[model samples]
Target: MGNITGFMEHQKVPLHYRDPMERIKDWNEIATLPTEEILREQASRCMDCAVPFCQDGTQLAGMTTGCPVYNLIPEWNDLVYKGRWKEAYHRLSRTNPFPEFTGRACPAPCEGGCVATLATDSVTIKNIERAIIDKAFEEGWVQPNIPKHRTGKKVAVIGSGPAGLACASVLNQHGHQVTVYERADRIGGLLTYGIPKTKIEQYVVDRRIRLMEEEGIAFVTNTEVGKQLQMDQLHSENDAVILCIGSTRPRDLNIPGRNQKGIHFAMDYLHQNTKSLLDSNFADEEFINAEGKDVIVIGGGDTATDCVTTAVRQNCKSLVQFDIYPIRPTKRAEDNPWPQYPVIHKVDTGQEEAKHVFGNDPRAFATTAQGFTSDKYGNITGVKSVNIKTKFNEKGEKIRDIVPGTEKIWSAQLVLLAIGFSGPETGLIKQTKVALNNQSNIKVKKDTFQTDEEGIFAAGDARTGASLIVWAIQEGKEAAMECHHYLMRNVS
Candidate 1:
C-alpha cells in the first residue's frame, strides 16, 4: 500500500448524478465527473490486500464477484496515487481493452469484491477507472498501439459487440490481420444500439472503434453474413471465422391481441427509437411514441428498466412494469450470505425516475400480462393482467397458474415486451451448419471456443446463450487464443 493509513482516513464517495426531475426531461448521461481531489482521495482508499479478491475474477454462489477481465486494480490505484496517470492508463488498458465502455455500463463487480467493503465502504474503483481513461483521452495518450509485425494470416469476426471487438483487439495486438463485420450501420452491437445514449454516449463507442480501425483492424458495416453476403463466401475468403452474433431472437408473448398495431418487442422498440433519433431526429419516420400515452412494459430486467426510462423521457402519461417473480428482499437473505451477488430489490435509474413522477414504484411483482386490449381501430388501448404463481407440472416443466379474482386492467396505448432472447437468429445458424447444444447455443467445449468445423470458432452470446457483457469479453479473449493456435498450426 502506498499510504498504509489511506484506507482508514478516506471514505467512499460516489460519482454525482443529475437531479432526476431535470435529467428525465432529456436523453443525456446522468453521471457527472467527480472533482480531481475527491477522485484522488478515493483512489487512495485501496487496501491492497494480500489476496486482492477485487481483481480475481471468480464465481461464488453462482455469481461473479470481481472484474471478469482481471484488471490490475492495485497497480493502477498506486500509479494514480503517485501522480503517474498515463502509466495508470497503460496498466488499466493492459487487461481491459475497452475500459470506457465498462466504466460506463458495467455493474462493477470489482467494487463488490473490494476488501474494504468487507467492513467499511468499497473503494471507488469504477470512478477511478473512468477518470484514468478520460484523462488519457484528454492528454492524447489513448492512441492505437498498432502491432509492429504482421502474422500474414487473416481472421474475420462476424459481430462487432463487446465480444467480437475484444477478440479482434487482442488478435490485432498479436499481429494478426482482423476484420470485424457488423450488420448494423455502426459498430459496437449492443453497446451502440441496445443500450441508450444516456447511459453510455454513442460517441464513446465511436471513438474506440475509430482507434481500433487506426490500429489496422478493418470494420465492414451494414453487411449481413447470411443474407446480404453469403456464408460460403465468408468461409472461402477468410482464414478463420469467429461468430459473435449474440442471442438476438427475442422471446415473444403469444396471446390474444398480440398482433395489435402498437404492441412491439422491447429490443425492436428500443432499437427503432435509437435509429430514428440518429437518422432524422424523428423527422421522417414514425416511432412507437410513448408521449402522452399510457405505456405498459412486460418483464423485469435491464431492458425493462430502459423502456421505463425511455418512455418517461417521451413524456408518457403513465407507465407500469410487470414482474412475474416475487419481490426481492432489501438485503441478502439468510440463505444467501456474503460474497454472493446480492439478489436484493433496488430501484434502478428508470424506476427511480418513474417513482419521482408517478408517486409510487411502477413495478408490480408477481404479476403478468394476460392479453392486450385494442381500440376500434386496432391500436393498443390497454393491457389485461393478473397475479400468477409458479408450480411444477407433471413433465417437470415450470408452469404459471393464474389466480382467480385477481384480474386487473391498466390503460396502455403501447405495450412493450421485454421478455429477453432465445438465441441467435436461425437463418445464419442453419446456413452455417454448425452444431448446437441442447440449449440451442453453439456447441463448444467448456474451455475451448472452437466449433465442429475446423478453422471456425464461436464466442459471446452466440456460444454461451444469453449472458453478461463481461462474460462475452472473456469468451472473446479465450476464443482468440484458440484461433491463434489454429492459425499457427496451419500457416507456413
Candidate 2:
C-alpha cells in the first residue's frame, strides 16, 4: 500500500509529449519522461482498494482489461512511492520480461481496469513501470542473467518478434541452448520492424538484444525457418521448435484500382521506414516517402494511426484517415462500464500530431474507401469513399448501410492500407504442414500450445492471429514453460 491519503491528494499527472511541431521536424521519441520526483508522486495514486484489478488482466466483452503480462502493478507502485526504484524494477520484472517495451508501447489496460478509475482517473501504472525499468538500466542494475548450468538441449525459435524473443529469453534462462532465427536481416522482429521508432527507439531494442546475446542466446538474422534453413533441420537439431512468425499476411483492399502503385500495406511501409532510419538514417531512400503528397490512410486502427504519425513526420502535404466504424463516445457508453476495458474515444499520438498540423482531426468516421483513382501512369491520384451507418440485424448480424449522398473523392498521391492482418503466412505453414484453425492461424492444442506435430509448438500471433504485444509476451512465457516440461520428458 502506498501513502493512505496520496490518491486523494494527487490527481493523475498527464504525460508530457513534445510539441507536435517540434516532433514532426525529427524522429526522436515524442513523449518526454517526467522527472523522478513527478513519477514518484504519480505512483502514489495507487489507492488501497479491496480488489486491485489492475494486476489481474482478463478479457471482458471481448476487450482486454488490466495487465496482460499480469504485472504486479500495485506492488511496484508502492515500491516506487517508497523510492525503492531497484526493488520496484525487480518486482516488475517478475511478471513482464520486457517492461521497457510494454512501458512505452502497451496501451496499458491496467489503467483502464484501475479501481481508482471507478471514482477518478487511474494511477499511472505504465509510466511508473517504465520509470523503474529505465532507472534500473541507468543505474546498471540490469545485467545479463546467464544461466550457469546447461540442459544440453536446444530450442530453435522462429521469428524475432516479441513472442519469439520472449520465448527465446525464457528458454535461454532455462539453460537450454537457444538459437533464435529471424527472417529479417536484424534481430528484434516486430520490436525492430513492426514498431515505429517514434514509439520504441531502436537503441532500446538493440540494448535488450545485446543483453540477450550476453546471456547466451544465439541470434541468427536473415534466416527464415523453412526456406534458407530446411524444416527438418530444426526438428533434427533442436529439442523443440517454436513458431512466432506473427500474423504478417495483411488483409488488403480488393476494390477498384487496387493495383495502384502508391498503395502499400501498413506493415511494409512501417518496416521499410524503421529499417531505413536505422540502417542509414533514411539516406538510402528505401522507405516509402510521404513528403509533399496527399496521403490517405485506409484504416483507423493502431496501425493506421502509426501510418498517420509516420506521414506527419515525413511532412505529407495533406492527410486523411478513414475509420469504417462510427466514432466512439468520449465517455463510456451505457453498454460499457468500469473494470472492463472502456471502449471510449481515444485520441492517440498519431491523431494528435495530425490534428496539430492539419488544423483538425484526420479521422473520417463511419467511412471507407470504395475504390482508388489513378493517373495515366497508374500511380494513385485519389480514393473514392462512402460514408455508411452500421446496424445490427434481427439475427444479431452487423451490417453497414451506405449513406447515398456521402460518396466523395479524396485527393491523394499515397495510400496506406492499415486495415489489419489475415494470419501467418502460408509458406512455412505449408512446408511444416501444421494444422490450422478456422481463422487460418496455426492450430494449437489447449494450454499446451503444441501443434499436431510433436516437438513443434506455436505462440503469439502465429497461434492466435493478430493480438496485443503484452498478450504475445505472456503467451511466449507460458509456451516456454510448457515447452520446458515437454523437453524434460526426453531429457532422461
Candidate 3:
C-alpha cells in the first residue's frame, strides 16, 4: 500500500471539466486531465485493501457496482502512485483493451463499489486509467498486437461498435483474420454517432482505429453485411460470423398530435449534428438547426442529457427537460447500502451548460408529456404536460399515475424524445437465419455466444439489450474465446 494513511489524509479531487459557458461554444471534449501530482494523490487514496470490492465487477441490486471488465484497480492505483506508468498501462491493458474509451465515457461504477467509499470518497480510478493510457500513447508505449502466425481462418464481425471491436480485437490477437463491418461511413457505430463529440473526441477514436488497422484487422465501413453484401455471401466467404450489432431501435412516444414536424428522435438529432460537424464543421447546414427555438427534451437518461447539450450549443432560445420520474435522493437511501451503485441526484454537464446560459436549472421533475400542441402547419408549438407520480399496479409493478388538475402547456418549438432504445433492429439480422427472443434480441446459448445456427454467434447489446459500454466489451471478449474454441476443435 502506498502510504497506508493516504485515504484518511487526502480528500477526493473531483474530475475537472471545461467551463460550461466556454465549452458550449464548440464541440470539443469537456473534460480536462489533471496534473501528474494531483492524479498520483488521487491514486494514493485507493486503500489497496485485502478484498478490494472496487474490482469485483458484478451486479448488486440489479445495477452494476464495479468495473464490468474486472480491471485491476488496486494494482494500477499503486503503480500510478509510485511513478510506474508503463507498468500501470500493462496491468490496465491486461483486462480492458481500450481504457481510453471507457475512461472518457463510462459512469465509473468502480468508484461506487470501492472499500474506501464506505467512509470516504472512492479513488479516481477512471481518471487515473485514462491518464495511464494517454501517457502510454504520448510515450509510444501503445502498439498493435500483431500475431506471429495466421490460422487462415476468417471471422466476420457485423458491427464496428465497442462490442464488435473488442471481439474482433481478441480474435485478431489469436491469429484469426478479423474483419469488422460497419454500416455507417465511419468505423465506430455508437462511439462515432450515438455519443456526442463533447464527451469523446473523434481523434481519440480515430487514433485507436489506426492502431487496430496496423494490427492487421480489416475494417469495412459504409457497407452493411446484409444489404450491400448479402448474408449468404458473408456466410459462404467467412468461416464464422459474429453479430455485435447494438440495440438501435429507438422507442417512440405515441401520443396525441405525435406526427408533428418539429419533434424528432434524440439519436437522429445527435447523429445529424455529428455527421455534419465532421463532414464540414456544420457549415453545410445539412443538420437540424435549433437556433432561436424553445427546446423541450423528453425522457430522463444519458441520451436526454446529450440532447440538452447539443441544443445548448445550437443557440436555442429556451431549454427545459421533462423527466417522468421524481428527482432522486441527494444521498443514498436506507435500502441502497454500501457497495451498491448509488441512485442519487447528479447535475450533468448538459444541465450545467443550460443553467449557465438560462440562469436556472432547466429540469422539470415528476413530469411527463401528455401530448403535443401543434400550429396550423402541423409543427410542434408546445407540449401538453401532466405531473405524474409513481404507483404500484395490481401485479406490484411500478406505473406512472397522473395527478389531477396538474396538466399544463409549455411553449416549445423543438421536441427531442430520448426515452431509450427498445432492442436491435431485426430486418437485416433475420436474413442470417438466427433466431431472436421475444424482446427482439438475438438468442444465444446459455454460456456460449453461439446462435441457433452453427458457426453463427452474437454478443453485446444485440444479444442482451441496450447496456453500458463496459458490459458490451466484457461480453465481446468472452464471446471471442468461445468462438476461438469452436474454430480450433478440429485442430491438434
Candidate 4:
C-alpha cells in the first residue's frame, strides 16, 4: 500500500487509442502509451485491498473474476507507483510468462474484480502492466534466463501458441530440453497469424521468440507432429509430450447457398491476410481482398470483431455483423452481480473502428444468418437473416427461436463465419489415439494433466476448448509442473 488513499486521490486514466480513421488505414497497433507521470498516478490508484480479489483468479458464477495466471497485481502496482519499474516487471513476470501478449489481447478480468471498481472505476492494471514491461524492455532489464544446469530431460511441445510457449518456457527454466513444434510456417501459432497485427504487432511476438531461442528452447516451424513427423517417432524421442495444439476446428454456419465462393472461415481470412501482410506487405495479392465489397461477419465475438475491423482496413464498401443472441443490457442484470465478469454490453475496438468508417455500429443483435443469396457466379451477393428471441427451457437451457415475419436480406459480397471453434482438429488426436471428452477435448484427470496415453499430456484449448490467453497460459504452466513431477518420479 504505497499510497493508502491513492484510490481516492486519483481517478482512473484510460489508455488512449490512435484516431480510428487513421489507424484503419494501416496495420499497426492502435493503443498509445500514457506518459510516465500519468502511468505512475494510475498505478497509485491501486488500493491494495486486504483480500485483493484482483489477483485471486477465482471462478464465480462460472466465469473468471480475476487474473487467471494469478498475477501479483497490487504488488506490481505499488512497485510501479514507487518508480521501481524493473522490480515491478520482475513481480509481474513471476506468474505471467508473456505480459506483452496478454497486455494487448486479454479482456483484463482483474479490473472487473478490482475493489476500486465497486465505488468508481478500477485502477488501470492492464496499462500499468504493459508499461512496466515496456519500460523493462527499454531499460535493457528484459533478458533470457538461461538455466544453470541441464536436467537432460527432453520435452516436446506441440503447438507454439501461448500455451505451448508458456509450457516450454517453464520446462526450459527448470533445465529441461524443450522443443516446440508449430505446424505453421512461423512460430507463435494464433499469436502470430490468427490475431491481426493491429492488436498485437508481429514484432512483439518475434521479440519473445528470439529471447526464448536464446534461452535454449528450440522452435521447429513448418513441422506438424501427426503428418511430417510421425506421432510415434515424437513419442519415442521425447521423454514427455505436451499437446498445446489449440482448438482449430471452426464452427460453421450450415444453411442454403453455403457453397458460395466469397464465404470463408474467419481464421482462413485472418490467417491469410496476416501471412501476406508479413510476407510482402500485401503487395503480392496472395490474401483475400475485401476492397469495395459488402462484408457480413457472422457470430459476434472477438473473432467476428477482428473480421469486421480487418474488412474495414481492406476498404470494404459496407459491413454488418450478426449476433444470434440478444444484446446484453448495458448494466449488469440481477443475476450478474459484481465480480462475475460483468455480462454487460460494451463496444470493442473493432466495432469502434467500424462505427468510425461505416457511420453506425455494425452489430445486429438477436439476428442470425438464415441463408446466403449468391450471384450467378456462385459468389455471395447477400445474406438472408431473421430476428430471434431467446427463451429458457424447463431444464434451464437457453433456446433461440426466430421471430416470424422478421426475415430480411442484407447485401453482402463477402461472408466470414466467426462463430467459434469446436475442438482440436481430429487428425492429430486420431493419430495419437488420445481419449477425448464429450466436448471433443482431450480428457485429463483433475489437477493431473496426463491424458489417456502414458507420458503424454494436454493443456490449453486442446483440453479446455476455446478460451482466453490468460487461461491458456495458466493451464500451460500447470501442465508443465505436473509433467515435470511425473518425469522426475517415473522417467528417471
Cα lDDT, all candidates: 0.87, 0.90, 0.92, 0.91
User: How well is each residue in 246-365 modelled by candidate 1, as lDDT tens digits?
Assistant: 999899998899998888889888887888877887786657789899999999988999999889888899999999987899877897665666678988889989999998899999
Q: What's the residue-level lDDT of 358 in candidate 2?
A: 95
Local accuracy of candidate 3 as per-residue lDDT tens digits, 1-492? 787678998999987998898999999999988899999998999886878888878889889998899999999999999999999999999999889999999999998898898888888888998999999999999988889999999999999999999999999999999999999999888899988999999999999999999999999998987789998889888988999999999999989989998999999999999999999999999898899999999988999999999999999999999998899999999989988998889999999999999998889999999899998999999999999999889997889889999999999999999998888888777787688888888988776799998899998999989889999999899999999999989988
List the pairs of residues colliding in candidate 3: none
Off by over 4 Å in 3: 393-396
Among all windows of 10 consecutive residues in model 1, the one with the lowest summed lDDT is 335-344
lDDT of 4 by residue, 1-492 (tens): 889889899888898999998999999999977999999899989986788889978789778889999999999999989999888999998999999998888989998899887887888888888888888889999999999999889999999999999999999998899999999999999999999999899989999999999999999999988999988899999999999999999998889999998999999999999999999999999999999999999998889999988999999999999988788998879998888888889899999999998899999999999899987889789999999999999998889888999999999889999999999987887877688999988998765789989989999999999999899999999999998887788544
State the number of backbone clashes in model 4.
0
Clashing pairs in 2: 160-189
Itemize residue pairs with steric clashes in candidate 4. Answer: none
Show model 4 residue runs off by greater than 4 Å.
490-492
Error at 454, model 3, angstroms: 1.1
* Candidate 1 positional error at 167, Å: 1.0
lDDT of candidate 3 at residue 181, scale 0 to 100: 94
Global fold similarity of model 1 (TM-score): 0.95
